[model samples]
Target chain A: MNSRKCLAFEIVANPAAVDALCARAETWLIEGGLGTESFPVAMLLRESLNNSMLHGSGGDPTAQIRCHLQRGRKWLKITVEDDGPGFDWATRLECRADIENCHGRGLEIYRLYADAVDFNRRGNRVSLRRRIAEVMTS
Target chain B: MTTVQVQKNDATVTLEGALTVALAQELRPQLQKAVAEGVSSVVFDLGRADVVDSSGIGLLIATHNSLKTKGGRLRVANASPEIMNLFKAMRLDRHFSVEGRQA
Candidate 1:
C-alpha cells in the first residue's frame, strides 16, 4: 500500500500572503509525487484559500486561516478553514450565474477545478478532494 | 511573475509569464490606469502566460468591464490549451473575447 502524507499551514488573512501559500502548496505537491497534478491543484488551492481569507475573513490580516494538503495513492484532499462569520453559499452560487459579472467567481472556480467540494455548517471551512489520475488527465 | 509591455499605440498590452495572484496584483493598477485614460480596443496578449488563477481571471473580467463602460473592447490572444480549458470550465470565453477556442 502506498503511504499517504499530509501537510498543514497557517496563514494570515491578508491578500499579500497568497503567494507564499501557493508556493508552499506547489512544493508540497511536487515533493509528494503528484507533480502532474500540480497545476490544477495549485489553481484550485489559490481560489479556495484566497476566498477563505479575502471574503470569509474579510481580508483581516490579524485573522488566521488554516490549510491542509493530503496526498494518497489515488486521491488528494485539501481543506481551508477561516475564522470569520460565514455566508450563504447558495446565495453566492446564484450571484455567479451571470458569467459576465466581475466578482463572485471564486467559489465557482473552486467547484470547476476540484473533483468534490464540501463546506462546513458555518460555511467558513471548505474541503476539496480530487482523484489524482482524473486530475492529471483533465 | 508577469511582465506587461504596452504597445506603442497604448492599446495593446502584452502579458508574459504566469498570471498568479501576486503578478495579477501588479498588473491590475497598470490596466486600470490604461482604461481610465480612454485607451480603447485593448488586446491582452497572453501567448506566454503559463498559468492563470482566479485572481488573474478576475482581473481580466474587471478589465473587460472597465473597457466596455468606456465604449471599448477587450480581447485576449494566444491562450494555451490548459488556460483555454480553464476558461471553458468557468465559461469565461463568453465573457472575454478570446482569439481562438481549441478545447
Candidate 2:
C-alpha cells in the first residue's frame, strides 16, 4: 500500500502571505509524520516562494504563486512556480561564500539543504527533493 | 515580536517568530539604530525563533557589517538546531559567533 501524501496550493505573490503559507505547510508536514524533515521543507518553501514573489513576479500582488509538496517515507519533493519572465538561472546557481553580501544566498540555501534542486528552462519554476530519515514506528 | 536591550556598549536583541524577509525589513532599522548608538557588541537571542530564510540570513550579515565598521562584533545565541545547521552550512559561523540552543 502506498502511503505518500501530496498537497498543492496557490497564493498571491506577497511576502507576508508567503510567511503564512510556510507556517501552514510546516504544520501540515509535521502532522503528516515528517518530523524533523518539516523544518527544512518549510525553510525551502519560504526561500522558493520568496524568490518567486520578489524576483519572478517583481512583488506584483496580482501574480499567483503555485506550490506543490509530495512526501513519501524517505523523501519530500517541493515545487514552486511563478507567472513571470524567467531569468538566467544557470548564471546564478553558483554558491558564493561571501559573507559580507546581504543578498544572493537563497540559491546557496537550496543547494545546501535540498538533495536535488532543479529549475525549468524558463527559470520560473523550481523543484527541490530532500532525503528524509525513516520514521521508526513504535 | 522583537525587543532590544542595550547596556553599556553591548546590546541584546531577542526575536520571536520566523526571521524572514518581512521581519528583516521591520527589524533592520532598529538594529541599525543599536549599531549607530555605539554598541560595541550585539547578541541576537533567537531561542523563540523557529525558522529563518535567506533574507533573515542577509539581515544578520548586514548587521554584522554595520557593527564591524564601528569595531563592534555580532553573536547569535540560542539558535534552533535547524537554524544553526543552516548558518553553519553557509559558513556564517566563520564570520560571527553562532551558538545552538541548549538541550
Candidate 3:
C-alpha cells in the first residue's frame, strides 16, 4: 500500500484552476503507466472539480478545495472536497436525458464514466473510482 | 480552452476545441449572437473538439432549446468517439441531433 505513490493537493475554488489540476493529474497518471487512462481520469477530475468550484463553493475564489488521488496497479481513486453546503447526491445522480435541460447532468456523467461515485454524508465531498484495467480494455 | 468559430453559412456555427467548463461561459456570447439573427439551423462542428463535459452538454442543450423556440434546429456533427459515447451514455443523443462522422 505504502509502496504505491499517492498524490494529494488543494486548489482554490475557481474554474480557472481546473486546467492546472487536470494537467497535473494527467501527467501523474501517464507517468504511472496509466496514460491510456488519462482522458477519463482527466475528464472525471474536471467534472467533479468543476462542480466543486462552481456549484459547491459558488465560484468563490477564497474557498479552497481538497483533492486527493491514489493509483494502484488496477484502480484509481479520486476525492474532491469543497467548502460549501452539499446537495442531495442520491437524487441528482440519475441520468436526465432531457437535452433541453441545461443543468443537472454532471453527476450522470460521473456515473457513466466512473466505476463508482460516492459522496460524504455532508455531500460537500465526492469520491470517484475507476478500474484502470477495465477502462483500458473497454 | 474552447473556441466557437462561426463559419456563418447563413446560420451554421462550427465549434472546435475542448468544450469544458472553462470555455462554456466564453462561448455563450457567440452563441447568443448567432441565435439573435434568427438563425434557422445551427450546426456544432465538434470534429476538432477533444473534450465535451457536462457544461458543454448544457450549452448544447440550451442552444438547442433556444433554436427550437424560433422553429430552428441544432445539429452536432463530427463528434469524437469519446464525445459520442458521452452523448449515448447520457441519452442526450436522443434529444440532440448528434451525427458521428463515421455514422
Candidate 4:
C-alpha cells in the first residue's frame, strides 16, 4: 500500500463560517489539481457541516463540529463529525405521516448532493464521496 | 422564522420567513386579496433568508399552484446565494420568475 495521506479541519458550526471553509477546500483542491470538482464538493461540505452543527449538535454554541476532508487522485471523501446526539438519518428524512405540516429537509437535500453517504455508530459521523473523474478542471 | 406582511388592499396576510410549510390560513387569504385588489403580480423577497430546506421549497410550489387560478403571478426575489444555489440546483429559478431580491 502506498499511503492514505489526508487533510483535516476542525470548524465551528457557524453559518457565516461556511463560505470561508468552502473557499479553502476549493483552493486546496484546485492547487492539488482538482479544480472542476470545486463547486459540488464545496456545496456538499457546507451542507453536511451545517447539518451536523444544527441537528447533530442541536445548535449548541459550545458544541464542537469537526470536518475531515480526504482526497486522492480518483476520489474525494468528506466527513463531518460532531460532539452531540446523533440522529437517525432514515427516520428524519421520512415525511411525517400524521402531521399536515412539517419543516426542514436538510438531510434529504444533503443526500441529493452527495454521491454516497454513510453513517457511524455514534451517528455523529458521516462520510460522503464524489468521483474526481466527473468534475471538470481548467 | 421571519414574518412578511403582504398588504393586498383590505386583506393583509403574513408570510413566514424562509417559508417551509404552506398554511392555507395565511397564504390563501393573501393570494386572494392580491387577486381581489387587482394586483398585477405578487412578489416574495427571499433576501433575508439565510437557508431554505425542502419544506420551504414546498411552500413556493404550493403558492405557485394556488396563484395559477387567479390569473395572478408569483415572483421570488432577493434570494441569498445560499437559497439561490438550492433554486439553481432544483431549477426552481427557471420554473418561476425569481428576480433578484434587489432589496
Q: Candidate 1 has what TM-score?
A: 0.82
Clashing pairs in 4: A36-A136, B2-B17, B20-B55, B20-B56, B77-B101, B78-B100, B78-B101
| lDDT score, candidate 3 | 0.78
lDDT (tens digit, per residue) of candidate 3 on A8-61: 879888766777888888788776678888778877998888888888887578
Interface Cα RMSD for all candidates? 1.8, 0.8, 1.4, 6.6
Model 2 local distance difference test score: 0.86
Q: After superposition, how far is residue A20 of candidate 4 from its true place, in Å?
A: 1.9
- Reported per model, the fraction of native interface contacts reproduced equals 0.54, 0.89, 0.76, 0.19
Best by DockQ: 2
- For all candidates in order, the CA lDDT equals 0.75, 0.86, 0.78, 0.62
lDDT of 2 at A64: 94
- Pairs with backbone N, CA or C atoms under 3 Å apart (clashes), candidate 2: none
Q: What's the TM-score of candidate 3 when only chain A is evaluated?
A: 0.88
Per-residue lDDT for A63-111 in model 2, tens only?
9999998877788899999988985789878757477999988888888
- Of the two candidates 2 and 4, the one with more favorable DockQ, higher being better, is 2
**Per-model TM-score of chain A alone?**
0.84, 0.90, 0.88, 0.77
lDDT of 4 by residue, A11-127 (tens): 677654654676678788777677766656766786677677667778775677888888766688999899877868666655442212223445546665677888887678889
TM-score head-to-head 2 vs 3, winner:
2
Q: After superposition, how far is residue A68 of candidate 2 from its true place, in Å?
A: 0.7
